[model samples]
Target: MFDAGLSVEEPVRGVVLLRIDRPQALNALTTASAHGMIELYTRLALRTDMRALILTGAGESAFSTGADLKERAGMDAMAARAQHMAHRLAFSIRRGFDFPVIAALNGIAHAGGAELALSSDLVLAVPHAGFALPEIRRGIMPGMGGTQALTAALGPRRAMELLLTGDALDAETALACGLVNRIVAPEALVSEALALAERIAEAPPLAVSAVTRAVRGAGQGGAEAGLALELALHQRLMASDDRLEGARAFAEKRRPVWKGE
Candidate 1:
């Protein structure tokens, strides 16, 4: 059910790490890669064993430069639209997944790359992992849902500034602006992401999924609604076998064996 275009591995239980492998193209989101991403997400969503996901790219140079302009070069408008749609669908699926999705940004993520990171539930970027939307300079707008996702991650004013200027925002700026959750040395990125995912996966799986969904529904409701949803999830988790084991282990001062019940 997996493809060779992208690499997938479960380095830790309940977390699937996906890496974009076309390092020659700066891991650019070609049409085939975009569709492959969508298919990968679909397959992962069906896996009961997975509780979270981490997305990254291969090589030390880039997380992704965004879409492969060279791949789209010479294609007609219709072909371009289809290609862009595939990319959009890929991001949308990642954003809407029931399980938490974390972005381990290892390098420069410009244009489409920034959009991809924005789709994740959390982003932990490397110190050299710069982010930007330089499509305006390319005489185009970000078509892969970057406009809205970027604005949602950062405020509209900042998002507009980044998009309009087509300038690069280094990891520091991205962290300061709340665009990225954390920044660490590139050498530590993969282990850090896996550790974070492992911590998340330690909790009750059902509660984790519900919390993810509830927080994502924040725009439709306020804090009260979100809290209510959290409470409901907590109640459900408390009744699960995993919660009982967690409590007994806490009292006994031993590690609990989670059943993900």
Candidate 2:
């Protein structure tokens, strides 16, 4: 259920590594690539054991520049909208994921690439990595949910500035602004991200999903709503079999075997 230009692998149990394989094109996302992503995520939904996902690019040059404009050069207005819709659909599926999603930026993340990283629950980039939203240069806008996601990642003022200026944000500045969680070595980027994912996979899936959902909701929902959601998810988890097992394991002083209930 995979496609060309995308590589899916399970280097460790319960963690999926998805690499954009079009390094020759800077991993730019064509409409077909977006459709491929939709198909890939749809197929991944059947894997109940998956606890984490790490998205990265194939090479050291770039994570992605996004929207293969070369391919879009011939597209008419209707065709462009269709392309936009495909990318939007792919991003929507990613946004709906309950498991933690990590973007391992090996190099530059520009345009929709930046949006992709923003969509993730965590972002780990290389020390030399750069992020930018340059859609304005093309007389377009960041339509791949970047406007909202960037605003949530950065404050509204910062996001507005970046969107308007179309400037690149260095990895250090991005880290200082809380856009990236860590700045890893280029060689260690994917491995470190995968290691983190492996660690996350050790925990109970139910708790992980609930935590991601509740915390990510804070961006859109006010504090009151966020608190309400957290409480609701917590209440739901209280009755789960995994919670009972956790208690039993604590009493027994043993590692809890989570059934993901």
Candidate 3:
């Protein structure tokens, strides 16, 4: 779990509870965490069980405060861009998963963190939680999808205000701006989010996944644009464990044990 700097929990069937486990630093993201998240998504995609995902922070203080500035203090421009791109890649792979992703924002979500929440299908936040895109203050634009997703969510004017000013919005203001679905108490956040996820999980998996693809694809470039990109990703996964398991199972005449790698 720490290998990915994330804590993955599946207490309920077909529901994944993924936490950014960096409370000491407000769950700030690092390069290793981003890469590990992408790796984890690859494994999860090979599985047939997942129906929903609840992404949140490990502690009560923050969903994430964006990238680890301390870690970035000495990074060159290329390294910094690479680190941000890793997080974006992780986000993209997660979108490929055929399920709903609910973001339970515990507290402040700034810069990259806001972009991460925008990546989810649904968002729930605590009353005191905040949202913002403060990259302008740092002189670099959002390396993730803040420019695109934020505009799509809040319209050009609202998104431009936050992007240009780096101002933060409280949970209520976020709700007013249609940035969050609802505000949950810190204690009730997980249980309620999990319950909501379980409710969605009760539906037919294939139909739900088809709907997910249709809706998620609508915001992106659409299925037609994804064909070539999908084939490229499929080719990249040709050497995965699940692929080898199929050949091995056939030769030995036994059921394949999917490694999901």
Candidate 4:
């Protein structure tokens, strides 16, 4: 269910914590690690009890510095192409997960790392954390969904500037650009992220999944289509036992005991 390069932990019930374990390489992902992540997320997608996920690196030096270029340097064109496909698949699996994902960026997150943070529903960074899409400096462009996610998170103009310049954005600038949601001290990063995850885990799981789908749809499609999808999901949830429990709890001034029905 897990691999040496990745560690999966449940620090709190219903909240899964995923840590990239290659701190010595600044947690840069190797091909194996990339596939490991995809497999982990795919497994989590089937779990009804998994309410939230937190992604972070094992050490304070980096959340991830992106792909392992050392490993890439030895690869032939065919190998490189395969690696690229795996990277894209990993991001796709992450984006498709039903529960919320919180990226706890403790340090540098560049190129593929930035794309990982972008795929998450929320990003929390340490004060020293930085982000960038430095693939331009490597004589290539980011091929791991970086371009589109950056354009969506920051405007096209700003995203273009960063991608072209290959400049790093510090935590403050990332927050200003809406690339990160909040900046916390390195020591507080995990705790704060876990707290947020726990909070989200308290909601009815079906409603949470529906909201995620609706918001993602709104971002990818027209308002009319997005609203239609939201309405359909809402109508489906309206008939669930959890919906009735929510109403009853509100009337009774008590917390809703969601059965995920």
The per-residue C-alpha lDDT of model 2 at residue 22 equals 93
Tell me the tens digit of each residue's lDDT in model 2 across 1-261.
Answer: 356688888899879899998999999998878988998787666678879989999899899898889888999989988998999998888878889899999889999998898888999999878999999989989987888978887879988999999999999999998999999989888889988998899999999999999878984667888889999999999999999999999999999999988
Ranking by lDDT: 2, 4, 1, 3
User: Per-residue alpha-carbon lDDT of model 4 for 1-261, expressed as tens digits?
Assistant: 457478989999889999999899999998998889888878888787989999999888889988889999999989988988887888888788788889999899988988889878899999999998999988999987889889988889998999999999999999998888999988899999999999899889999999987876766767788889999999999999999999999999998899999
Q: Best candidate, lDDT-wise? A: 2
- TM-score, prediction 2: 0.97
Candidate models: Cα lDDT each: 0.85, 0.89, 0.83, 0.89
Error of 2 at 246 (Å): 1.1
Q: Which one is best on TM-score?
A: 2
Give stretches of model 1 more than 4 Å off. Answer: 1-4, 221-228, 244-254
Q: What is the lDDT of residue 164 in candidate 1?
A: 96
Candidates 1 and 2, the one with greater TM-score: 2
Per-model TM-score, in order, reads 0.88, 0.97, 0.82, 0.96
What is the Å distance of residue 130 in model 2 from its true position? 0.9
In model 4, where do residues sit more than 4 Å from their true spots? 1-3
The true-versus-predicted C-alpha distance at residue 104 of model 2, in Å, is: 0.2
* Model 3, C-alpha of 258: deviation from truth (Å): 22
What TM-score does structure 3 among the candidates reach?
0.82
